[model samples]
Structure formats: structure tokens, C-alpha cells
Target: MFWKDKYEVGVELIDNQHKELFNRVEDFLKVIRSTTLGEKKAQKVNETLEFMKAYVVEHFRDEEEYQLKIGYPDYEKHKQIHDNMVSFVLEVSEEYEKSGYNDALIQKFAGRLLTWLINHVAAEDQKIADYAAKREGI
Candidate 1:
């Protein structure tokens, strides 16, 4: 349960997506760390990776839309961050496939993913919430 109430961006859609991301990444970590057989673990990892690719894109799209709606001052910078992450995920997935679903690569990817999610939700996304709050005088 890496997700915390404090990490919420005060937007229902984005907050829910954040929670889902946390859950997915946490599941990924558990799978990689488990005593599951190598084949099963690799299969699960591949599934998770595919899900993340699609879900992350959808979530970012929605979040960016919200930013645009509110005229968030950092929209461009924030979107660039999202774009970079998407590219990273795509690049990693490609590498993971090329490596024949190597365990070491996925293990490393999971760690980085968790760290990025936590930082983005708790810090970067918080800025959006704060800006929205101030604008609304909430």
C-alpha cells in the first residue's frame, strides 16, 4: 500500500488512477520478489508491463486534460515529464522483450517504477493540487 491519502492530487480521476498505479506497481514488486517459478513470474511480469503501458498513457492523458482545463501554469513542463516517462516505459518494455523477459531487468525496472511513482505522486502531482486549491480558495 504505497499510496497515501497525502499523495492525492484532489482530483477524483487522477487520484484514482494514481492509486491504481501504486497497486499495479506494488503487485509487480511482489511478483518479482516471490518464490513463484521463473516461467510464471515472467508471464505475470509481461502482463503487468503491458497493462502499465496502456494505463499510464490513459492516465496521463486524463491528467493533462485536467491541467489544460484549469490552465495550470506548469502544464507544458508536467506533460513533458509524462512524455518522458512514457518513452521510458516503452523503451524498457522493448528491452525486456529483447532480453527474453529477463528477471534482472524487470527487477530493476520495478524498483525504478516504484520510486518514480512515489516521487511523482507525492511531489510533482502535489503541485497541481496546491495550485488548484489556491485558485479555488479551498
Candidate 2:
């Protein structure tokens, strides 16, 4: 439900993937915010984290490919942003596991994830659409 029409980048594939990411994150938030705790909560959080580990990489790869296809001038910069986010996610996942799936750690991670997702989709990704529109005269 955090996803909005304005966040779309006008690329069907990317838009769909973005929506999936939003949905996943929203589900993640719900799981973490629930009254459940201990093993049940950790199990749900781990599942969502694992899914994000794979899906985020896949989505970034696809998005980068699209950027290359369009010859987006800021492809390198965009990729760096993606790379940084991927690193952060991985790092946090590791920390969470090492901490025995600490609740506070995940709560912090969820907040950061939400902020990053919104900013990336709403602002950063919009630049891509704007460039494509200008390039293709859309």
C-alpha cells in the first residue's frame, strides 16, 4: 500500500518489479510490527529477508540492463546507488543473524529500507523516466 502511481518510472518491467519490492517491504513491515515475537516473528522476518536478498539483486540487474539499453547517461551513478543498497542489505542481514535475529536490529533495518525504497522509487527512478521521455519524445 506504500506504493503510489507517481513512483512509476514508465518502464513496465521496472514498474512491476518496483511494485513487487514495495509489496514485499510492506509485508515485511507488517510481520515485524505484529504482536508476535520469538521464533514465530523471527521465522517470518527471516523468510522475508531471504526473499529480499535474492529479489533485490535480480531487480537491480534488470533495471541496470534497461538503463544500458537506453544509454542512460547516469547509468554508472545509478548502478553505484544500487550496489550500495545491495551491500547495505547484505551487511544488515549478516548483522541480524550474528545477533541471533535481534528484533531491534530488524526494526532499524525496516525503517531504513522504507526510507530508501520511497526515495529511490519516487525521486531517483523518476529521473530515468524523464530521460527516456526526452530521448524517445514520449
Candidate 3:
């Protein structure tokens, strides 16, 4: 999915991280859709999976900290959402590895990750932006 300017939250660090997130996810999508075949494709998938495992947790931590900094009323609930997503990612990652890098598992992961990121940023995350803006009279 495209990273629109509207997704920016007036926080340079967070906005940059979000943009990088979109780029990484797009790379993941390309690797999945590429027709390279054999180990080459699997290699890229493995690389992306490894990057995402840590990157996602880092991003969520930063995002949650931002929410708490601004005293967002929904901080608790938002954190819960992040926690749930992280749990899902870890679970899937473990299963995917256990199954010897199953193609279907990663494919399913990419699809769900795409949907979750888009919806979370476009919907749930927008609330934080709105709250920040209103607080700052922006």
C-alpha cells in the first residue's frame, strides 16, 4: 500500500519510521510476487521475515511511547492492539520456521500484515494524530 502524506502525525521520527515501514513492506510484497524461483525467492523471503520480526516490535514500541507521551486517552487500548499484532507475528514466524519455511505460511503472513498495517495506520492510528493535532491547536 502507498504511504500517503496524510499518514504523517507531525512527529518527524514517527513519520519517517512509518515511511520506512511502508518501503520495507513493499519490498516484502515484491519478494513474494517475484518469479525468481527456487532458493533465490526463499532467500529473499527469509531475509524479509527476519527483518520484520525485529523491526515490527521496534516500531510498535516507538509508536506506543508516542501515544503515551501525548497522553492519548486510548493509549491502553492502542497498546493492546499492538501487543496482539506482535503476538500474532511471533506465533506465525515460529510456525513458519518450524514448518521449514512454508511458502503458504509466509504468503498468508504478508497478506495479513498488509491488511493490518493499512487498517491500523489509516484508522486506529489516525486517532492519535487527531488527538495530537487538537491538543496543539493544529
Candidate 4:
């Protein structure tokens, strides 16, 4: 439900991955708001955290590959953006672990993440689609 037609990059695999990422983020938000007690709460949070760390890296790699395949002129800049996000995720993950899986930390992370995802997909990624369309004379 977080996906919008405006965010479509005209790439099936990447678009599907974006949807899955949104779904996972939704699930994470649900878990965050839940009042579950004890280890069950920690377990769910940990699972979502692990999933995001891995999935984002994989998704970025695939997206970068697609950009390279099409010879996107801004591929280098885009990859830099991807790297920055990965670094941020890792830094937050480390802080979360060091702080004993603090919910406050993840709450802040979620806010920044949602903002970045929306902007990246709706603006940055859309640039690729726009370029491709123009290239094809669509």
C-alpha cells in the first residue's frame, strides 16, 4: 500500500523489490507500535532489523546493476547515494546493538528511513525511468 504509481521505475524487478521493502517497513512499524512484553518483542524487532540490513544491500546492488546496464549517466552519483544509505544503516544497526536494542534508536531510524525511501523512489529513482523513456522516444 505504500507504493504509488509515481514511484514506478519501469523496471519490474526493482519495482517489486521496492514493494517488498515497503511491506517490510510496514511490518516493522507495526512491531514498533505493539505493546508485546518480554522476549517476543525483542525477537520481532531483531528480525525486522536484520531483514532490512540485508535486503537494502541486495536491492541497492541490483538497482545499481540495472543503471549500469542502461548506461545511466548519473550512475556514479546514484551509487554514492546507495553507499551513503548503506553506511547509515550499518551505523544505526551498530548503535542499536550497542544500546541493547533500544526502541528509541530504531524509532529515529524509521523516521529517517521512511523519508529517504519516499524521496529516493519518487524523485531519484524516477529520474532513471524518465531517462529510459526519453531514450526510447516514448
Candidate 5:
């Protein structure tokens, strides 16, 4: 997915992290859509998956911190969304491993990641931004 300027929430740290996430996800999609298959594609996919596994947790932590700092009332609900995503990623990673690195599983995982990231940033994260803006009178 591409990061658009409109996605910015006037929070430099969070905005940078969000941009990095979009870049990583876009790179991941490129690998998945590449003509090459098997080991070559799998290598890139594995790298991206590993990055996502770690980066997502870090990003969520930072985002949650921002929410708390702003006294965002929906902090719990926002956290639940992050927790669910973490769980989904872990579950899918385990299933992918058990399935012997099945291509189909990876494809499905990528598709869901794309959709989830978009909605989370565009819909969910925006709510946090709106709350911050109102409080800051920005």
C-alpha cells in the first residue's frame, strides 16, 4: 500500500512509523506479485513477514502511547484492535509454518494485511487523530 499525505495526523513520530509501515507492506505486495516463485519469492516474503512481526508490535506500542498521552477515550478499544491483529499474525504465521510454507496461505495473509492496514489507518487511527486535534485545538 502507498502512503498518502492525507494519512498524516500531525504527529511526526506516528506519521513516520505509518509511512514506514505502508512502504514495507507495499514492498511485501511487490514480492508476492512478482513473476518469480518458490525460493526466490519465498525469501522476500519471509523477510517481510519477519519485519512485520516485530515492527507491528513496536508501532502499536507507540500508537497506544500516543493515545494515552492525548487521553484518547477509546484507548481500550483501540488496543483491542491492535491485539487482534497481533493474534491474527501469530496464528497465520504458525499455520503457514505447519502447512510447509503454503503459497495459498501466504497469499491470503497478504491480502488480509493489506485490507487491515488500510482500514486501521484510514478509519481507526483517524479517530485517535481527531480526538487529539480537538483536545489540542488544532
Candidate 6:
């Protein structure tokens, strides 16, 4: 939900991308938590969703490139994680549209996104950083 200093992997570009991701996700959560629920709020939610779709793809590409550059041992596994997330986002976006932008669906998506992002950054990503540190002396 929030970016912490401890999350830094000591790779400047990747760390900055992670921070940007955290910031965007935090803002998305804040918008979802807002009490105003109507055309205005729905517009904001749609905007955030759009941003997520594009930004997530870009971030994942950069992360994957970083992994490839470093010859990360678990690069395949990490890429699978990214692929799964992309698929989930696409599926959710379709469902959101089919449901006429239902508030409940959006809320569920937000909750899942929050948990997923935290776990990915705090746990999964840390593994990559640990390996890079140990193998490459980063």
C-alpha cells in the first residue's frame, strides 16, 4: 500500500520504478476509499484503472529488462508473476466493463490489488533483490 525505504533493492532505476508504482497504487486506493460515489468518483476510478493498465505494463517490462540484464536466476519465475498479473488485470477490466462498472467489483479489485502489490513488492521482489545482492554484489 505504501512504499517503505526498506523496499529499495539498491538498483536506482528499479527502485525508482517501484516507488512510482507504490505511489500510484496508494493514490488509486485513496480514490477508491473516498466517500463520494457517483459520476465524479466513477470517472476517477476509471481514470485510475486506465493508468494502472498502461503503467503496470510499462513497469513490468522495465523490471523484466532489469532481471535479464542482471541474469537473475529466477527470471522465468518473476516473468510468470508479471504475466499472471497482466492477465488478471485484463480479466478484471473486462468484468468491470461487463458489469457496467459496478462499485462492488471495483472495490474487490482494489482490495486484491492492494494485497497483491504488497506481497509482490515485499516478498516476491525481495527475493530478486536478495539474489542480485548476493550474486552481483549490488
Q: What is the C-alpha RMSD of each candidate to the true structure, in Å?
A: 1.2, 1.3, 1.5, 1.6, 1.4, 1.7
* RMSD from true fold, candidate 1: 1.2
lDDT of 1 by residue, 1-113 (tens): 88899998889999999999998888878878988567778888888889989999999999999999988999999999999999989988999888877767887788889
Candidate 4, residue 106: lDDT: 74
Per-residue lDDT of model 2, residues 9-120, tens digit only: 8889999999999999998888888885557778877887898899999999999999899989999999999999999889988987888778788888899999999999
What is each predicted model's overall lDDT from 0 to 1?
0.89, 0.90, 0.84, 0.85, 0.87, 0.83
Residue-level lDDT tens digits of model 6 in 1-138:
489988888788878988887887788778777777566667766777787789889988988898898788889999999999888888888887777668788888888888898889888889888888888664
TM-score of each: 0.95, 0.94, 0.92, 0.91, 0.94, 0.90
Candidate 6 Cα outliers beyond 4 Å, as residue runs: none
* lDDT by residue (tens digit), candidate 4, 46-84: 886788799999999999999988889999999999999
Q: Which ten residues in a row have the lowest lDDT in candidate 5?
A: 36-45
- The model with the greatest TM-score is 1
Candidate 2 RMSD to the correct structure: 1.3
Clashes by residue pair, model 3: none
Candidate 6 residue-wise lDDT at 74: 88
Residue 53 lDDT in candidate 3: 81
lDDT of 3 by residue, 16-87 (tens): 888888888888888778767667667877777787788888988898899888899999999999899888
lDDT of 5 by residue, 2-67 (tens): 788878887999999999989988988887887766577778767877888899999999999989
| Span of 10 residues, lowest total lDDT, candidate 4 | 36-45
The TM-score-based order of candidates, best leading, equals 1, 2, 5, 3, 4, 6
* Pick by lDDT: 2 or 6, better one: 2
Q: Which stretches of candidate 4 lie over 4 Å from their true place?
A: 36-39
TM-score of 6: 0.90
